[model samples]
Target: MRLLVIMSLFALSLVAARPDASKYPSRYDTVDLDMIVNNKKVLESYLKCVLDEGKCTPEGKELKAHIKEALETYCAKCTEPQKEGTRFVIGHLVKNEKEWWRKLSDKYDPERKYVTKYEAELKSIS
Candidate 1:
C-alpha cells in the first residue's frame, strides 16, 4: 500500500511538471515578425538579447523569458498564430542566419536537445 501511494505521487508529479497546451500571452503575438526577419539589424539585436550579449527590449525580454519553455514544450502553449509566427521566424533564421542560429542554440539548447525538435510542422515552413 505504501509503495502504491508513492508511485501515485510520482505519477502526479510528472504530470504536474509537464506543461499543458494552454494559451501563452497574446500581447506579443501581434509583433511584426516580417519586419524583424527582413531587417538584419533588428533580428541581430533580438539574437543578442536572447544570448545575453546585449540589452533586451520589452519584447526581447518577453521572448527570452519564454524561450526555454517554448522549446521544451515545442510551443505547446502558443496560440495558433504564435505557432505560425514561430515557424516563420525560425525558417528565416535557419535559411539566412546560420551564425546567429548557432549562438542561440548554444545558449538555449546547450544540451543540443530542443532546437531540432521542431518536428514536421516547422519543417513544412522551412
Candidate 2:
C-alpha cells in the first residue's frame, strides 16, 4: 500500500511537470523587426516614414499601403536570399505594427500631413 501511494505520487508529479501540449506554441516565436532590419538603409527609411507620420493620422491607411508597396519593391530588387531575408524583416514589422495597434487601441492616431510624409519616405526608399 505504501509502494502504491508512492508510485501514484510519482505519476502525479510527472504529470504536473509536463507542459500542456495544447499550449506548445506561444507568442515567443513572434519576430522582432528591429533585430531583423538592423542597420539596413531600406528598413531605416521605412521606420523614418512611420515615425514622421506622428502616430496620430487618418493617413495611416494610405501610409500602410505605401509601406507595403515599398516592401514589395525592395524585395523585388533583392537577390533570392536577400529577398527571403527582407521578407522575414517585413513580416516582423507587420506583425509588430499589428500588435502595437491592437494593444494601443485608438490612442495612436496621426494627421494626414504626417501620414503623407511617411508615405513619401516609403516611396523614396522604394
lDDT tens digits by residue: candidate 2, 13-113: 11111144421111212223344245455343334334343341222222332333333233232223333333344333333444332222222223322
Those runs of model 1 whose alpha carbons end farther than 4 Å from true positions after fitting are: 1-21, 119-126
Query: Which residue pairs show collisions in model 1?
Result: none
Quality of model 2 by C-alpha lDDT: 0.27
Which residue pairs collide in model 2, if any? 55-109, 56-109, 56-110, 57-109, 57-110, 57-111
lDDT of 1 by residue, 9-122 (tens): 000011112234365556655566777777888776777666778897766666666676676666666666566677667666656776766666666667867666653444
Positional deviation of residue 103's Cα in model 2 after best superposition, in angstroms: 15
In candidate 2, residue 91 scores what lDDT? 38
What C-alpha lDDT do the candidate models reach, one value each? Answer: 0.54, 0.27
Query: Cα RMSD (Å) between model 2 and the true structure?
Result: 22.5
Q: How well does candidate 2 match the true structure in TM-score terms? A: 0.26
